[model samples]
Target: MLSRREIESYESQGYLHIPAVFTGRDICEMERDHEFMTRHWASSGQGWTGPWRKEYMDAATEKQSQLVAMHDLHFYAASWMQAVTHPRLVEAMGDLLGPNVELHHSTMHTKPPETGHPFPMHQDWAFYQHQDGRYVDVLVHLDDTRHENGEIRFLAGSHAQGALEHITCTPEGPCTPHLPTANYHLKETIPVPARRGDVVCFNIFTVHGSYVNRTSQPRRLVRLGYRDPENPQLGGQSHGRPGLMVRGHRPNPGGLHPAYSSEVGALDAFKAVPEPALVG
Candidate 1:
């Protein structure tokens, strides 16, 4: 659980960092999974260009494609799912969002050197629907994330207000069509530096994005979206599109994961709505 001070920091700053959430072995296994998947995609004659090809491109080099479709739909089963669902990480989320929460979706952003591009500024909630209370996103960095590596940049206290309308800029930088409700708050952008094992958590409404990787190495990270159980579902579209909802754990069942321990059970706060449920 996060300390009161830590929680306050998150509230005021819109994001917080937790260090060493994984072990060296865990990182090794995840990297192996990434390498295996990239090689598999390359060998398949996919040519690393298309709808899902972005996943293969190295973020630091921008030489590889971005957003490759390597793993099956249920990202929770991907190589890094174990680390993504770590107990400490879960408990901290439960602390902020309450004991009951559901894993909404998972997407990986693997930026390569030189060619890595910036993620446009946008509100995650603008894409997700939640009838419950608050929504949270946990970003797990597989590699050391730094400013040079195109780490995340966020505006503090942006969540206290609602979503801001966004428009495309001439060069493709994120531009708000108008000022956010938070208003002229000095547009502060801070880079969240994380170690190999650290995870960064933030509210959904927070305005955040990342820059192109200037370094020669890859910057890899997984973004998992979670929501409170009782929150009302907003009538809209699915954020992860196509993959849809997998079965949810009842009362947040923990044994669903083979690696789950007594201290950690399933997130009790949510019921997974099926993909068709959105239209239903």
Candidate 2:
């Protein structure tokens, strides 16, 4: 949990970065898990399951790598979930929002060295459904993030109001589709940088995006999602294949299942969940 001052900083600044949220060892383990999945994951057969399935590795890896994109959902599995859903994270969000929250989603993002595209600026909840008035997202950096490497940049406090409608992108720049003029203007443009163990938390309605990675190193991070538990899943068919939470509850009951939930541990607590060789 954050100090009173820290929460105030988040309220005022619209964002917060908890540094050293993971360790170098933790990062190494995650990367190993990723590489193993990539090398062995059949480009032509079946798919991944269990721990890796969340958008934070919550889904599946495509059979082949597409140009400028190499996404593999649920790459880290439940272990990654533990990192993404750390207690401090839950406590922080609880303070900002409330206690009745559930794991909405999670996604692991990676920009390979020298080959990642820019993510256009936009609002998250505007795209996803949320009945509740409040929703939160946390990004855990697996490496040193920086502006040159295409770190996240957001307009502060835009989350206060609801979604800004019909914002369109044009050759001139991003603009709104309707109305006499644009209410959109950057209040603050800050590049969120953090070490391997750091986590960046922000509001769902905030306007944000990251540019293309220009550096020579891979940029990777885990995006963990939390929303009010009562928010029901809206009826809709996903264009892409989807992963549904069959059933479960928080504070994992254990039984060799990756999706099980458990209590949040110490801040420095991080341990690798064992698995077979990435290649079957």
Candidate 3:
């Protein structure tokens, strides 16, 4: 999946871009299905909107700006399920995080042509935070991306500082937990252009953002968040949900882990309440 040099690079730099991890044909099929999936969510107010959105768009641009997305594509599309669980991807997770890797969540991050919105500089730690630094968020690219098309940018080694406080805006959107514009500038980050079938992996605490996609083609990326089994979440998206383990089995370290919450609590509650008498 990754060599020792690459792993060291990711550890020191807090990000790594591995090219052509998937096949062009397979990714194309997944992209096609992504289109198929979005149709179901159309007219569902799926695009970005809210008071905080104005920070990234002017009046005219705001009127045209749009970002199409959804969460947990594996639930809806089999191709995506296979794509995320691809041997290379899961193995890479093992290489970076640990032998036991678990998936935190997945989300669609497709940017439609011309009017695609830009994401402000921010750390993912703000959205789905954890107690430790053994987590990573991977971007599986289904289309070629470049600076002109708003490729993702990273402030190298920023994750070494650990999670920084981000400006909390609306409940959702690209910049829901963005950095203040006054200090963190987008141009200061290094752009990471990638091609179709490429995958970019970054630490959840790395400062990252992108510019608007001005091209007439869509910038397609599906985000897959993964972590080692022992690194539990403090509180954020999908908190208390012990998700799928991709590499090794989820380790039981005792004491109230999300993995045991449902099983343990349910048994205790059942014992306390006692079984109800059989009814017709």
Candidate 4:
């Protein structure tokens, strides 16, 4: 559970960094799983099916075997499923989202060496809109993340202002939605450097992005999202895959698709779940 000051900090700053949420043993297991998945994807030549799939494929083709990112990893690997539904994560999320928290989605972001990509400043809420903006993202660091290795930077207190307008740009040809560059200059930003096993939790409305990795080591993080069951989607956008109820009982199970409710944990067997359209 979070202390009063920690909770207050999150409410005011829109983010918090909790160190060593996972033990050394846990991180080791996660790293093994991560390595296996990366190798599998690279060898199979199965590019990501998400919005950035094209960019990922292009990079992999050019680089010969670089794995950029993976979406809905919980559906593919048991280790990832265990990590997302980890009891500690659920407890922390319960503090913010109340008792009935549901899994929104999970993603794995990999920044490889010097050529890792940078994400433009934007709000996750823009992609996954929910009523009252009752969504939070928990980023679990699988590797040491620092400014030199593409650590995410956040604009403090930006969530209080609610959602901001995002514009589409094709700076390199493949169009992507992001907040205008001018908005990035409007607030004071801070780089969130984290160690492996640390967890960084932030509000969905928080404006954040990262820079290219300059170091030779890979920086990887697994992001899991949770939301109050009461806050349904306003835009009717499906996660592409169904969401799992990880904590407490859902009073209105009907709101969730049957596919999501049927599973308890380790959803590797459910091959029918659709691939997420965007990273979100």
**Predicted model with the maximum TM-score:** 3
C-alpha RMSD of candidate 4: 7.9
Task: Estimate candidate 2's alpha-carbon lDDT, on a 0 to 1 scale.
Answer: 0.54
Question: Which lDDT value does model 2 have at 37?
Answer: 51
Most lDDT-accurate candidate: 3
Candidate 3: tens digits of C-alpha lDDT, residues 161-230: 9989887654553435677777888889989999989999999989999888889998888899999878
Candidate 1 local Cα displacement, residue 63, angstroms: 11
Show where candidate 2 strays beyond 4 Å. 38-76, 166-188, 232-280
TM-score attained by model 2: 0.63
The TM-scores of all predictions, comma-separated, are: 0.68, 0.63, 0.86, 0.79
- Which residue runs of candidate 3 sit more than 4 Å off their true CA positions? 42-55, 169-175, 255-280
lDDT of 4 at 68: 69
Q: Point out the worst 10-residue segment of candidate 1 by lDDT.
A: 44-53
- Computed on alpha carbons, the lDDT of every model, listed in order, comes to 0.60, 0.54, 0.81, 0.73
How high a TM-score does candidate 4 get? 0.79
The residue-level lDDT of candidate 2 at 129 comes to: 48
Instruction: Estimate the Cα RMSD of every predicted model relative to the unseen true structure.
Output: 9.6, 12.8, 4.7, 7.9
lDDT of 1: 0.60
Candidate 4 lDDT over 77-153, as tens digits, reads: 78778888888888888888888888978777786776566666778887677777578988989888877777878
TM-score of 3: 0.86
